[model samples]
Target: MKQPLKVAIVHDYLNQMGGAERVVGVLHRMFPEAPIYTTIADRRKLLPELQGADIRTTWMQSIPGILRRFKHFFWLYPFGVRSMDLRGYDLVISSSSAYAKGITVKGDTRHICYCHTPMRFAWDFATYMEGNEASPVLKAAARLLIKPLRWWDRATSARVHQLVANSTIVQERIQQHYGRSAPVIYPPVNVSRFEVSKEPPGDYLLVVSRLVSYKRIDLAVEACTRMGKRLIVIGDGPDRDRLKRLAGPTVQFLGRLPDGEVVRYMQHCEAFLFPGLEDFGITPLEINACGRPVVAYRGGGALDTVIPQVNGLFFSEQTVESLEHALRSLTHYAWDSAQIRKHAEQFSEEVFIRNLASLIEGQLSSRNPAARPAVPALAHKKKGAVL
Candidate 1:
């Protein structure tokens, strides 16, 4: 019998849990034997599913205080990624938003990069620095590094055998920045975790996101305050204090809550508010799974998931006035809970796995006609066969 193909997964870092880390978790489940390689992994911040996985970190992990202040050592990540030795793996899949895709792989190994977006700091310096609270000296240093980082980021795109984008906007970015076209694969959402609420929707609006400046959470707070609409803000970040000062008495900050409690909020909220322009926003779909409509900014990933008057409404501008107008407009529409939930089911984790598995298998076959499958054929399997 032919030996099974050796597979490996690479990510920029595993220090924080977010949509990117969630994608890595799904990738780990798809290829259970594949060891995950990263520059660093913060055990305390790793997701429950990733705690038991075979995670291998680079020398950067040994650096003092790297976990708490990884961004301060941004210039060193490319070197850290290059230090990974992926020689024996027949296939390597990189889940990257930054330096992971720059990993040096053997010529024979097929490297597929599931790019969340090209490194935001490199390609969109101003936007990346907008809401950040770095010191003036650090900010100036980062600005100087941006040009060289952009060069490195562009050069690394050619290293991957195949590129997969998480959204259409990201796909466009790949073409524009790297001169490479990538197929769009929408990120997965665990729709099964949420259920349509039997109870009537609550009066307050909801915002579940990291309280970051670029996220534009301020729009939600300011708009709700001006309109005197009750708003519940979940998740905490560096921008928390500024947002709290901007918020009115009607706005409440819950900070971070357990996933179960978040689901309860989603199920009960009159409408979920998404004020940021994300590459792909998964939270809106989570709320949609709970049969709640979303009021979101019109651009970015929102274009791909939210169908106006179907599952969510969109504000054309990213300002408080525009979002407030959309919120007011939401009251006039007749939303069908069942229809909203059905729309969200399309982006479920199962669909993502099947699509990604098929892509991997196809790439492996094309590379070596007689080679064994790199990923199991989850698309053709019966229910509960490989999940």
Candidate 2:
């Protein structure tokens, strides 16, 4: 009998977990036996599926309230990532928004990286300088670190045998940040979870995110308040109170909802409003998969997922004024719910699993040309059985 595949997966910090962590969870589904490794894991607030998984982490997890001291971890992450025990796995799959791609791998093992974005602060420091969030001293330090980290980020690209990006936007980023080419495989959307239905329209629009300073939920609140539009902000973070103060009486806070409740709101909402520059906005895809159109900030993954009239409209700039214009213009056009769902179907979980299975098979087959893989026509089972 053939031996089962042995895979080791690595990621960056698993603290304050969000979409990228969910992507790792999806990978777990494909390789159920694979043990997960990362820099940090906060089990208290993590998804239930991740509870008992064999998640190995760096010594950073030993630090008390590591997330509160998160800024310090960045200084130690480089060394922490290099220290992982990756000596025995047949395959290494890294789901990275940061330095996990730089993990040390043996020459005999194959590697695949699903890059979320190439360590944004390290590679896109110039663009990030536009934000006034960081102090000048810290910005200067980040700028200084940029060149060296960029070199390391690029050096690691050659370590991976295959690269898959979440969107064309990230495909471009892969080229610009790492000088590497990667195929676009849109992240999986659980299309079946959302019920695409018409309902009594609420007075407010929604902005769902982690409420980080970079996410710029502040801009969304400011724009909606200034425009006299009602807004419903979901998800909580350090910026919640700050964002709430900026919003008007028309704004409501839903905090974080279960995956099911969020979808119910998505199905019944007037339209989903996604206002951040995400590596790939899986939430917007989830919203669209629910037959709701999105009003997205023009940059990032929105460029690939949203078509102006087909499913959603885009704001040219990531500013308050621009999003206001897009929000106002969105109501002028009508979007077909069925077409929106169809566009979303193209990025469903089934597609991701299929593509991943193909990529892994291709990698293993290339390693062993003498022994052919099972026929694709057999549907992963023995042939000559009734359909």
Q: Highest TM-score: which candidate?
A: 1
Query: Which candidate has the top score in lDDT?
Result: 1
User: Which run of 10 residues does model 2 get worst, by summed lDDT?
Assistant: 378-387
Clashing pairs in 1: 235-255
TM-score of 1: 0.96
Tell me the tens digit of each residue's lDDT in model 1 across 60-132: 9999988977887889999999999999888899999989999988857889999999998898877767655
Question: How close to the true structure is residue 262 of candidate 1, measured as C-alpha lDDT?
Answer: 89
For residues 53-160, write the lDDT of model 2, one tens digit per residue: 789998878888676556544557778888898997778899887788889888557888988888766777654444345577876676677777777778878788
